[model samples]
Target: METMLITGANRGLGLEWVRQLDAAGWRVHATYRDPAKAEGLFAIAKKSHGRVVPHQLDVTDFTAIDRLSVTLKDEAIDVLNNNAGILPARKKFGQTDYDEWARIMRNNLFSYMKMAEAFVEQIARSRRKMILCMTSGLSSLSAAGSRGTASKFGDGKHVYRTTKCAVNMLAINLAGYLAERGVIALSVTPGWANTEMGRADLDPGYSPDDLVDPVKSVEGMRRIIATATIEDSGRLMRWDGSTLPF
Candidate 1:
């Protein structure tokens, strides 16, 4: 059976990914910042008959990451989904709070790099050889300036946008660096997902089910990842299965 280790598994898209992958028969090592607060996740894991294992992880804590790495050292992780991200309050240019921006960068970009560094070897030993980074359309420079540029669900904020852009660069850089190791690193934008970090409306005009359901996005991502080659690495892609410009 394939194995996936996902960060941020307590709620929203992360929780849904755990559920879907567990149901589909993959062994899931799902991490949450506060496992004690993860009652919903624990309930699902119980329902899954042990397919999901809740792990304690705070991405910003390198020591926590190292400890988890040692704990799972014997296991080969087939996929590493870098799904943890934060959206600090929005601001533009000089008005952007440096501290908040740095926090977002640390959580969304730096920690992602640290996680990949910690687990790349485990992934290399596995057969799937894929690493997926969750990114956003806001990461696309081409799309950033367009009118009606709000996220598909209508909430467009600058802090989230800038961090995702950084994430895109980090993923691409990893893809290039790991090319010789036969690992493919790619970024996927889950598109206007309906979560706390996403837009709040669930109108008929919006396909909130498709937008919010991490299962669908993940299944699509699986197909894309399974078919990936060195040629496909370092690309920014959408959940609808389309390529986006970096």
Candidate 2:
């Protein structure tokens, strides 16, 4: 069976990925910041027999990542899903919270890079050497400037958008860097999903019908990841497997 490691597997999209991937027969190493709060993931793991393994991981902590790397050194990881991210409380340009902006950058962008660095060797040893980063459509300069359909999500989420944009760039750069090693790195947009963070007050306004279901979103993204080839490396793709403007 293929082995995959997913960060932020406690709830929302991450938990859904764990459930779906485990059901699909992949040996999943699901990491959560707080395992106590991951009762849903734990229950899924209990029923997974040995296909699902939950590990404690705070993506923001590089030392913890290093420790986890040491523990899984002998294992070959087919896919490293950099899925842990945070959306800070919104603030306009003039009222920007520098601390919160830094925090968001750390969780959303830097941590993804750190995870890739920590596990690149294991991914290189696998059959499908891939690093998938969960980005956002809002991060695209073209999508953000769209006045028609994209405007429905509202504006002024500078910190979140900026961090995701940086992550997209990071994925492209990682793709080029790892190409020689046959590791494909791509950034994916999960669309506007109705997750806890998606519905948070800081999030852009969208109706219940406008938001995609977490299960549907993860399912689409999983298909994209599963079918992605070396030619698709460094591309920014939507959940439906269509390419999006960078």
Candidate 3:
């Protein structure tokens, strides 16, 4: 069975990935910040019959990441999904909270780099060498300016957008750095989904009815991940297998 490790697997898109992959017979290492608060994931793992295992992990915690690396040293991780992130309330240019901005950057950008750094070797040794970072279409510079149309969603959300843009760059850089090592690094956008973070209140102008289903979104992404080749690496791709602008 293929082995995959997914961060932020307690809820939302990450949880769905764990469920779908486990059902597909992949051995899943699902990590969450607090397993005690992840009853839903725990139930899914129980039903998985040992295929899904949950680990307590805060992606922003480097010490915890180091400990995890040591624990899984003997195992090869075929895919490492950097899925944990925080989306703070939108702040206008003059109203920006520097402290919150820093926190978001640590969670959304720096943690991804740390995860890749800690697990690149393990991924290299696996059968399907892939490091997938979950990004957002809101990260697109082009999309930022074209918000008058119905297709466009987020307008401001400066912190979230900037961090996701950084994530795209990180994916591209890792792809180049790990190319010779036979690893494919990709920044994947899960699209606007009906999750906690995608609620109408959080992402104004888009209701749950306007959002894609989490299950369907994750299913598409899993298909994309399964079939992605080295040539497809370093691209910012959507759940539908189409390219998104960085």
lDDT by candidate, in order shown:
0.81, 0.88, 0.87
- TM-score comparison, 1 vs 2, better candidate: 2
What would the TM-score be for candidate 1 when compared with the true structure? 0.89
Sequence-dependent TM-score of model 3: 0.94
Candidate 1 to native Cα RMSD, angstroms: 3.2
Q: Model 2 compared with the native: what TM-score?
A: 0.94
lDDT, candidate 3, 1-246, per-residue tens: 899999999999998998889888999899989867799889988998888989899988999998998888877999999999888886666888998899989999999999999987789999999999999878887775222454344445888889999999999999999999999999999988888887742434646887779998998898888899999889999888988877
lDDT of 1 at 2: 92
- Model 2, span 1-246: residue lDDT tens: 899999999998999999889888999999998867999999999999888999999999999999999999998999999998887776765888888888888999999999999999999999999999999877898777333554533466888889999999999999999999999999998877788877773234456666779999999988987799899999999888988898
Candidate 3 has an lDDT of 0.87
Model 2 spans > 4 angstroms off = 145-154, 201-205
Better of 1 and 3 by lDDT: 3
Candidate 1 local Cα displacement, residue 190, angstroms: 0.6
Expressed as tens digits, the lDDT of each residue in 157-226 for candidate 1 is 6677778888899888999899898888989988767786764433345555545466676677767867
lDDT (C-alpha) at residue 40 in model 2: 97
**What clash count does candidate 3 reach?**
0
Model 1: weakest 10-residue lDDT segment is 145-154
Worst 10 residues of 2 by lDDT: 145-154
